[model samples]
Target: NDKLKFTIRGSYINNLTSKNSRVNLNTGVTWFAGKGWTVNFLNTSSFHRVTNNTGSSSFTSSYFELGINKSFDIQQPRHKYYNYTAVFYKDLNGNRIHDANEPGVSDVLAEIIRANPEQDLKDKNYNGEFLSNELYSNDKGKIEYDNIVEGVYNIKYIPKDIQNAHYESEGTEKQFVAKKDTVMYIPFMERNKLFGKISLHRTQHSALGDIPLGNIKITVEGNDKTYSALTDKEGYFEMYIPVSDYYKVKINNIFREHFTLRQESYIIKFNGYKRFELSFDFDEKARKIHFDESDFLITDEEENGNVSFEDIKVIKQTNLRGIVKDANSLLPIHAIVSIFNNKTGELISETASSRRTGVYFTSFFAGDSYTIKVKAQGYWTYTEDLYLNQITTFDNVNRDILLRKTYIDEEIKTENLRFKSGNSELSALAKAELDNLVSTLFLNPDIIIEIGGHTDDMEALSVNAKQLSEMRAKAVADYMKQRGLSEKRMKIRALSNHDPKSRLDTPEGRAQNRRVSIIIAGF
Candidate 1:
């Protein structure tokens, strides 16, 4: 092609007529890179030698040359070129960190303006017109501008040009020195508003209309943060939230004392909407009494059903209360009832059931997880997990506990409670038996028992039978106590080799003797 060319030239000279010799060599290549541009490389070598009486000495030297040449007209002005790219993304979190879930916003119009007016005028004079100053972002939220003159510039955007009106840029504009290729990352945050209303149904199964639940508190929990708002007298509330896939909306526990909701919480998902409206209904716990329309001011009016208030029984009082009874006899019993925080195990409330009526009373704050423990002298500790979301419900306030008595001197098959040879660790079979034993001990809080360890008669097979026996017994006692049985109720005894359940003449007999036995000591 005429646009490019390559060439090489060389010259060599040598003289051999005299004792002293001289040589010269020259090589070079020239390339036509592009329009009015050329690249060249040239090398030269020289050699000289002199003959003397003692020895001959020679001198050699080489020269290399490399350069780029361009032909230009003096009338044309020199201009340096630069490239720029801009990327836009939604800033879900205001932290300025680009998270994986945040997506790009496309088709946004951006304007490039030179910061220096002199440079701007020069660019316009040289380029004729700056038509590439304004462009829209591509589908990938990127805008690429090439062949821009080297200068300081600013990239600006119009708020209305963005895809959503609720979005606002993180910065007023981007300022960069376009000395080389550069990229700008711009982030925008979404300001979404949600409006909500909370109402209460006056009567069950009837729409005498709904009354606005004033002063009710609502909370939105997500992103490891929480936002709260209160309803006005008209049951209207508004809150602004960050962009997220899901947020849990729940009524504050303070408002739960007077109302109950069938669905305790709601999930809100932002789907690129500027505004949202939501409504929730709650069952009011207010007492119903006989009253005429003239007796009080009613806020709502609807004709869903009509019933006589005289037939409705008014509840005088209500409490967080329950009854304790025997599981088998179904008779009222006296026991200690306690509530503990399920997470921290801290005691929150403690009370005793009446000896005569078997009724216990205690109160708790709503929206907390707790462990309800009921214990008696000879009954297994009864435990139930409770989450008090709404305190005004009938079942929420009424919790009954049934106590089952512990097993007394129950025969546990001893053959299944043997340990491995030369090991004090309880086997799976032994652990299973000990679990049953622990349950008995848990309910029989007043009972004291002894754990006895025995071994077969094998003096040559064992180094220290008594020590191994003691360890086996202690292992069983330790396991039971760890499972909620009191350590004070257990006593360990090592009865090695002297009391074997079977003859040690056989391996099966030895296995039977290597066992731990539970003995009832006192109650």
Candidate 2:
């Protein structure tokens, strides 16, 4: 009996219905909405058994689940109290109580923010948000919280499925001292909005060209709300505003003005020209913007479908610039510059060095010869003839001119001052002309001169012309010194008939050959 007991074994049942595999066909549709609200239209009733025992009876089961759950509040205090409710109304009075005249605002967002620690449960999820689809408020405007805990909370009214209304927070945030089974309530408010499209452009301030202006900031200041948007890549923008008062609009720091939204929707364009129109499109929405074409005006509309504004700039040509200076000092000086067109033999332009700065500037053309004459009142004239040899389009050509002091050479004159024949005495005319020369020296105290006398060939061969000329030059020098002039201001010299004023055999030649010469020595 002991050996039989140790060898004994049990027989197995092959297949039982409950012991076989079961199929769980989960088929649920979840509709996720904004602000963390979701609805699960699920059928938990679909199920079947895969395998069953041959001698056993099988069974099928199905059920429908209709439920609502809240977000697992990680900050929810331990639930030792009753559940609570929150109602959203169309309007609430200043006393924070629901009035009998106020109707319920269904589908309006209601949420409870808890101020407590959470119990970390692994399987049961709590997302920490609330929804009011319960039978207590007739399943209309109430969000009920189960397993209520003691904590501080705030109830907010959030608008959903918004249309053309201006929805703003109406100071409707209600703080909850949530006791046990209390129903909290708050008000939701809204206004109307003025919708419009804004188009911007950067047309060359001139008639030359234009381009799309993008990334420019546009701000709309209004009574109820202020909106800001940056222009897109296409230089287009739009704004949805609340009840339009006199709204002041600013476009990038360029300019600002105010406008009233009397119509439903309008279009604004910053354009370069009145006739040039930039194209855009508008859709047929409930409150759509319509642009009636018009030239850029602060307060006016055209019969056509357009809006325009003017923003222009002038075009300019290239120029040449530099300073005029004294050649010795290398410092700026006021000099007169005369430009001449050598090809046309005409004076093209005349510019002067600025007395204040001595800087000079002018424009010129290529493929032309220009004679630049730079002169000052006290300095020698500087004449420079140049050709704009290279033909190219560029800017800022530089040309600086320097002038020297003036000095005169008496030999450059055609006829020299004459004396009486065979006599070293000054002629009546000669002394008269000498009066002018002396007066010039008197007026210009800085001027000094050299005096020289020369004789003709026939007169020199007959008399001691060399000695006579020397005596004549000395005599003229003495006359000037006796006239109250400084002897240090003059130098006297003489020459024979070798240097003649003229080569012709005539009385005029002989008279010009024998003369006294004067030269500027210093100033």
Candidate 3:
């Protein structure tokens, strides 16, 4: 109950009255047993709030009282049954036994669940995870479930802090019963698990040596979810992913407009190991992709959980097109056009020209120089170096290669051999081209051959031009001799500037003039 009063004097500052409110609830129960045994239970609650002009205050209180009367003739039912006990001991050897230094594990929460035999198998908790009817264990590291109604029962234990504790059931659910009292010895497993780290490096084969690729974005897709990670500056990455044997891996550099590899979809298999160390390998379909090394080492700390992918750069690819035509007829010819990195000579992509139109399509990144190698069945090989600058609004490159027929004494121009700048040292591509020449000479062993090296008129000094031309031709002959050919079977001729392939009028014509040719000499 509360009362309030107010008085007005001047305009606004007179007097203000205070008010209070009170609420209460009470309930009682009397459980009576025959002959005088009775128990009385009382519950009461009250709340009061007082308010002035400034603020208010509230107080709440509750009371419960239970009374029992003792003298009574009522008898308690007694059940004759033994107690079910649980004894927990540490198996230092993980064999579920309490050996010499091993002692009983104390204060572990071991709950008990009991269900009737005829109950439907669908009798599950709201989460449909566990069965109903549970009991907790005592602090003595022992659980005693007594007078267990003649039904099936199961004991379950889960680790509290997995860092220090862990457990596993011995496949005995729904089978343990208490027709008579029984004691159960549950097994526990230590939480120590085999952990490891992974290192990612991308190795590339180049004319100089092997190169490592970095800033690669990788994803390991599992059954439930996918894990993303980025390699470091040294092309290293590690993560703590769930156990999975087969993971769908998708790796690319699409964000920076770099099409390093056209094939990114891989069904990778992670072999089972307590501490697994491994790397990835891409087959014929993996072009311009580097597989440096996948290294593995074991550790107890799980640090891969915090691995982030903030630094890896991805890129998009642009569409590139061209056609292949014959030099004499200028007509379309079916040929294979392959792209490689101009700087590293790493093969990137390969496509064939259509049979009817000789049209071809491919994908490449912008702002990079690429070398295209075209090969047809009856024609000599051709290679061209080109540069594409547009990245935003990319335009198709219409490079039509003119391939010459390969016949006896025709001196058809093939891919120019790559040599070390200002030196006669042959590059990988140069060696590959010489291999084809050696095969041709071996097939026609009954005949002799002459290799001629030519130069454009660009070299100002005639002596320097003649020297470079002769050195290049001698390099080719030396390679053929190493391939089991006699020195007498091959002859080298240095023909500089005099017999240019075309007029040294433009850069393209000059490029055609700087070459080496294989001539068929008499037997």
Q: Give one digit per residue, the lDDT tens place, for model 1 in 446-523.
A: 778878887777732655888888998999888887888877888889988777888748888888888888766767
List CA RMSD, all candidates.
21.7, 31.5, 29.8
lDDT of 3 at 426: 69
What is the alpha-carbon lDDT for the whole of candidate 1? 0.71
Each candidate structure's TM-score, on Cα atoms with residue i matched to residue i, is 0.31, 0.26, 0.26
Residue runs of model 2 more than 4 Å from their true location after superposition = 1-83, 91-102, 109-113, 116-139, 154-175, 179-183, 197-523
lDDT of 3: 0.59
Report the C-alpha displacement of residue 49, candidate 3, in angstroms: 57
Clashes (candidate 3): 11
In candidate 2, position 334 carries an lDDT of 82
Per-candidate clashes come to: 0, 17, 11
How large an RMSD does model 1 have?
21.7
The segments of candidate 3 whose C-alpha lies over 4 angstroms from its true place after superposition are 1-82, 97-101, 117-140, 162-175, 204-523
The candidate that wins on lDDT is 1
